[model samples]
Target chain A: MISGDPLSRVLYIDLSRRKYWVEDRRDLFEKYLGGTGVAIELLKEECPKGADPLGPENPIIFAIGPLNGVFPLASKTVAMFKSPHTGNLGESHAGGRSAIAIRMAGYGAIVIKGASDIPVYLSIYNDKVYFRDASALWGIRSSHTVGRIIREREGEAGYRTIMRIGRAGEKLVTFANVVTETYRHFGRLGLGAVFGSKKLKAIVISGKRTLKVSNAKAYREIYDEIYKMAVKTPAMRKYHDLGTPANVVPLNNLGALPTKNLTQARFERYENISGEKLAERFLGRRLACAHCPVGCIHLAALREPYEKEPYFYKTTMISYDYEPIYSLGSMLGIGNPEGMLKLMDVVEIYGLDAMSTGVILAWTTEAYLKGYISEKETMGLKFRWGDCETYLKAVRLIVEQPNDFYGALAKGVEYASSIYGGREFALAYGGNEMPGYHTGPAAHAGFLTGSRHSHLDSAGYSLDEQAYVKKEELTPEKVADYRNTYSTRYNKGGIHKKSSREIRQLT
Target chain B: MVKRIAVLDVDKCTGCQSCVFACTRRYGEAGVGKSAIFVRSLGGVERGFIVIVCRACKDPPCAKVCPTGALKPRRGGGVILNSEKCIGCGMCVEACPLGAIFWDEENNKPVVCTHCGYCVNYCPHEVLGLEEVSTG
Candidate 1:
């Protein structure tokens, strides 16, 4: 620790005024160790008590940890803001080039405040920053194209991170996400929508600055030890082999897959979307964040044919994990890889929250089936299970906010159901949609009290599973500890075998 | 028989900065941020990362451009800067297209790769490794 690392510095960028300045919050970094700890303080300082999440008052803060550039699995950057979706604490963690780029750019954190009158993207190079024109990129349907263009023009290749929003974000969908490094994201609670509200579409950071370490010799020894542990350890092996999709079967076997929006806890079609099946059927490649030995992100090879030319075929590589399967597969009762991949791709294109999007679509389907909504509300497209085309259309409509019904759905399951008639299985907590877990009351309670309303908050979902596995009763006190730990997010490195997500819990 | 080259692969990297810290820690005894090797993310994280250090080019451009001959390529791999002979003229920074060389503003001298391969061991993703490569 550099007692006061130069990164003890925080840069504030105001979009409304198109001005920027640096703040040396040495006190915050020294106390918090960066990331979530710093982000919470930044949020407190930047967001007004009664500020609208989508208003100019909301601030977006990005923070990386002390161990970030210096250690493995410490590559995650914590993003904090007042969520446009939840109107409370919005935090997300993403790996890829974000942490390293931010660190190398020589700052502990970057806080973005106010809204821009025109669309702009911030480019930070060594000792200088530029807000470039992003007018042409405002309506691009494909997030991939935005990345390709930015990568071609960016600085410090392999040393920069380009973060941008897709059409869903530009459209101001409450659940829109910002995509970075093709596969990583600040993926929850409408950070992208906030970006859209500010007329800010993207952020590109680059640097090659050096950092000082406290003990080089001991650092080398510890580095080697962790490297060997990463390669051989079971905790990381599961992530390396099958990635997060490994959860599909185990959760199913436990009768906790959240099939059809929790109409049932387990999905009978589990084998079709199982991690093993996906690895065998479509796993094309695997990749990891910078410096992490465990390549946990899995990409699937989705081979599709030309609709007009039956013989013509094109293969696309799509990233998949347990979350997508839960949100897009069983949650919607679709197990076919083709439909799942297409639906996932569309969700990515629109920049919507895949989990929230899937759960909302599922609720809409159930609502329509129960006659809560009619043809007039659906805008003629029947909300059906396992239909990729309609599901993709629904995701787009959410981005477009085509009607009042879809507009409410975009708000989230709980809010959407309040107007449309289905709170019993609305599948949301703290105004955010539920993750793909329904093990017991603890999972639900975790969402209700979990600061970010994220499944990883306290991993109370695992508590539900643990109780069932041990065949013992869980007292309310035990559950409260789990919820409190989740609320404080202060567990001292206890990520374990049962819930791998405990390792990557975002603030 | 001491053969070493920093081995980097595109496949196994997770874009983590463990190696960056390890490199910095090597100099951390005095302070942090003094490591020879640097690892950062390239573009968005999903696109992957860029790990920067001495590649130990067969005919080193950095050494050739140094007016003081401060940069010297060692046998094992990479160039080590001679603090005694060095003027902090940033010619090597401009000359080396890979941009691996670093001039510590605080130290007022040019810094390049020492090629101890300590950073390789720090890379948990196996993105960095020291292999034997002979150019003789």
Candidate 2:
């Protein structure tokens, strides 16, 4: 029954020293707010300058907003670290009980530092912390299996989130991601690789709490207003219906959907992967983040069998969003809808960043086709356009690092392109692979300056699309202003020296 | 005469969690320990949310075993807590099958829903609304 602001509490775990501690950092929460604000500061403190991105010193920071558990739309938890893939600021936002559970579990943030000598999983139940041995679960290929295992073993199934990594992370793939709740992920910047480097496997967090708020009347009023916007708004309705994949056809028509490694802006066979077509042909289920009214998560069921076995088959539920479709489908020339879904499924099972993996595969395909790398390099797999099976096989070999050429592929698109001669077509800004938008220069600018270098960093792509396609207006200044405004609002890491009382209260 | 635990529709709930914060705000704090209402996911986020609350039963086992007789039944099915009489032995907390009994360790008392319906006022989605039902 902690009183006042529970934001003051912090849970600390040491993988190297294998020690844990609790501290309070109320001042951090009071001033900077929560989520990205708190995580950046914590990252700077724990991450030594110029340290290895995959080293234990890199530090994994999960910060929840003050509004989480209290307000809607605030359920997102921000994950921050120096990305192994980009070697720069790596960040991703996730829902699905991650943020709400973290806040309610009686901690403002959970910091994992140092390295574990053996594989392990951390379970947080109420005020208790259990470091369970994870040797049996080690080397598992699918991220889904890891989540299913933890859900059954952990207490508070409905209330907990099992955040785990797959073979990609365990194998230290630079583009690996940390999967939560089987589907949602800290999907970019290689948080999964960092987890693997530390020999850490998974984290299960659950808590039932009583959070205090400031003016009960005003709180309810604001809450209702936001809730109304989410349910009744056309913006939410669009996502609810088709999810983000709805943008496929429209972006393709606008000549903004990056395709064939950005050599062509519009994917010629866009209808094959359009959101409308998917809903009509394959949409099996729609899911949402925790408490989110907009069920934008679209799952398409694809049943495929082993190439050698005629009788064996397995049904794969693949999650697809706008960026993955564009980066993996259009950009890689995966015009076949079923092929795109299979690629997406492999990416999820391997726990790699779909955008990064797609971009990397696209780079490899083009590079191999142009004779940059021949049969001597690709192990004799003819990497051709729309050859999804070879690309999927390439993804597995990238994790295994079967060839010296592919050892570099696991790094990321930017690194691969730099060594292999496709910088212009690399289509990556800030070292991380680009997301699925080619609206204009503002999108590039957002990637350039956005701390996380993400499409959502400023919604510049949306601004660019709306201007030229929606309104038929080409105002670069307005788009630039949009980027600047967002960067300032969310660019939270400041070198502020806090008083001891405040720092102790916050972390 | 509100007598039933409010049910929320996920199709209508925009994931605002207004009910949760409202419960805590009523206590003038910023943590979930004081919140009587909780909103969580069914499994993965793709599944949706389940809002757990006090059912406000007619025969609340919480009131029946109050060591200090602090948990008294209101005119409605909901129970009221007399903090002054509570010993905070947690008998009521264990007695609750709904897991709705809130313990305020700082005050050494149990927190119960008085059916004030403060959460309903904040519910923007109209997923929650007070319906007066007859208590048996």
Candidate 3:
């Protein structure tokens, strides 16, 4: 690490007091090397043990690594908080302008503590932090509109990163996410619920500064090498071509897609929602992170007509990935690509973590089918597989929380299943909803034991696939040991893995 | 032979800011404090990037507006700065409609594109390139 290559300033904001201060935490950055290292330490310091996840005490920490503005592919913002969903270590990562914007703003880590009394948004431009009133922007229908309104209001365009939540977050839905840069997110582990608890509606960060490199020539050489690798590598090409939704067909064919509450791993009508089909039909745009050249963020153009007028139509740009397609498409047994996109749109609009929302809805659909839940519990709406219209209604009910069952459903599948008696098909591992993969036993075991209890925590699905390919017999202890060693080595090396989100929970 | 940094295709620009970083890197920096080129989103990224660089204009207005004769019309369409003569006035910045002249706050000088074409190499999408323009 170059001396002062990544900024070591930590910005501490107390929402309760509406006071802010800066600390030169060079020691923390030096010891941990930023990102998860710095964030975990900050979380430990600010978040009390056994603190209420939605209380005023829980701290939200965002940190970036040294490679943030200096290199390609180091574009992740690690968000750590006490998870309302899992009630433990809440860690999630998002790639957009989040890390770059934060790093450029000259901070290795930002610690936001205490809860505010009213709705507000934090606008951090260079060295100044402004607490703006967001009373009017509070109850917007779509998170996209919130982003648009803030984007216009802030007027930073390309320089700023806007992170906000939708109605799900305002209502404190446990699996709600913080959407950043429109498409990207601090997606998993209920970061939005934490934001809701703090009454922080949005955060806009922008900055410009010149960083010194120990060796400029060597830095250029290394940057070129990484940039070349990113564009040329076939694995990265996969991301660029069709985005993550490309995995739909292959995972479905392999019986690893995790469809319909895991009753089947393969979707019968997988082609309709496959990456090839979606790109061929509805792909509207592709976007990249600040430093990354591989433009992988794919948005689908979903055009629908107004109910009153058949000729008038509106086209919505909906972002899609493998996890969402697996959860909302196959997991919900929806064959129509448009149907899947509509569900995804609602999830984004509500700022719900699509994976969790899908899994919870899948569980709800199965519970309804099995007579474990009835129309009374579903608020007189029958949830059938592939019926996105009914699922959309359920999502609205969840955010609205009209009754006890809907309120429980808003918490998460695990809590809802425990209350409603569908633990067997709830499809939650360690209190959090399961990811899209059903590759093997290690997948489940890793979810059960991993630090964050997330697929990205250990990437047991990758290990399972690797083991199957090598024909190796693996024990539970072996998987745990492998996870431990990988985490330790990568944590020290500062090597980030997209498959495992290795930056988050290395400790 | 007058070389100009021409934007070949704005649509292909990914707004990765590789060009921005590369331009600043020429002055021995790793970030975007002093870059002659600017790439901003046209509202959102879906509309594509606005690659604002020195268009190598004929009869450059920036050179005319400089009070201290710091900026002189180069062989190409843009202006070359003599840092020693610069008074750090705001005239040239307002003169250019493209906003291609980036201010170096630390040095108290205007950092204008000299058409070095270092950024063209860094742009993976081939959105920018150097072209020999007629010095009319």
Best by TM-score: 3
Per-prediction fnat: 0.47, 0.42, 0.56
Candidate 3 residues A48-79, lDDT tens each? 88899999999999999888888877888999
Locate the minimum summed-lDDT window of 10 residues in model 2 chain A. Answer: A491-500
Candidate 2 CAPRI assessment class: acceptable
DockQ of 3: 0.66
DockQ of each: 0.37, 0.30, 0.66
Against the unseen true structure, what C-alpha lDDT does each candidate score?
A: 0.77, 0.76, 0.84
Best candidate according to DockQ? 3
Model 1 residue A4 lDDT? Answer: 42
Q: Residue A322: error of model 3 in Å?
A: 0.6
CAPRI grade, predicted model 1: acceptable
Q: What would the per-residue lDDT of candidate 2 be over residues A63-118, giving only the tens digit for each residue?
A: 98777776666768889888898788888888767887887787889999998989
After the best TM-score superposition of candidate 2, give how far the Cα of residue B64 lies from its true spot, in angstroms.
Answer: 6.8
**How do the residues A350-415 of candidate 1 rate in per-residue lDDT, one tens digit apiece?**
777788888889898889888888889989988777777888888888888888987888788888
What TM-score does prediction 3 earn? Answer: 0.94
